[model samples]
Target: MRLFSQLIALSRSRQLGRQFKEIERCIKALPRQARARLGIQTLREIGQASRMEFPHLYGTAPEARYLPWGQGTEIGYARALSDNPEVALRGIALWLAVAYHETKDCTHAALQAQHRQLLRVVRELKESHRGGDPVQEWMNTGAAA
Candidate 1:
């Protein structure tokens, strides 16, 4: 099993009292292997509403970019969510290789570093999303019509 060093998120929210809890919950629900692949040795997020800071996780879309805390590591959220996750050169390459169906069974997977693309396209489709569907989608779609 491989893992990155520890990461901690400390926040002060205007309402809930535990801001990064959503992100924490989502990450915590991962399988041991998934969590290990995520690479953070420890994910400690204390918050109230939703702001957060995560290491190694990159966001590749507008929907992925909403977490309002940048304790330092912010490459790009639109890359992938953990369920769909991101890893910059490494992650994007890995995500493409592991992409959707196989993300759960990454045991003994090997990736050569040169596979990253100059242009990456991420389509944020909703497949039985855990949280309620983002109302923004409705508004955006409706507004576009």
Candidate 2:
């Protein structure tokens, strides 16, 4: 029984290791700016931010009230984009995934609030991106005006 249990634990560990590797690969695949937007500087930061943002989802706390996801989230994202694009992109991806999942049903009041906040953040980011590069904006609009 002991041997059987040890083998099962080893197999589970291997599976978890593979999953972590895949996640790292996916993070690396993202563009530098995108990664920065995601705020992917360090694993510690990600763990802390995620833990605070979604305590319930992460099984950290019973009451899962997120901090105000407004200007602060946007500022962090923008700063990450300028300072460390890679980290930002990873953080952005994680945030988007969580927001998308939480808002999909649009049933819970808290989730709905967060979904709305996420939309605002996205709009602001889009505007900043467009404003920063006129050439890119022109191309996006299809041909120079």
Each model's C-alpha lDDT? Answer: 0.28, 0.44
Best by TM-score: 2
Model 2 score (lDDT): 0.44
TM-scores of the candidates are 0.24, 0.33
For model 1, give the 10-residue run with minimal summed lDDT: 111-120
Q: Return the lDDT, model 2, position 19.
A: 35
Off by over 4 Å in 2: 1-85, 132-145
Q: What tens digits encode model 2's per-residue C-alpha lDDT throughout 39-121? A: 33333333444556452233223443453222333333343344464455544444444433335454444445555654554
Give the Cα error of residue 115 in candidate 1, in Å: 38
User: Considering summed lDDT, which 10 consecutive residues are worst modelled in model 2?
Assistant: 67-76
Model number with the top lDDT:
2
Q: What CA RMSD would candidate 1 show?
A: 18.2
What tens-digit string does per-residue lDDT give for candidate 1 at 29-138?
Answer: 65545544443211111111113233222223445554443222222222333345433323323232222211222232221111111111111111222224468666
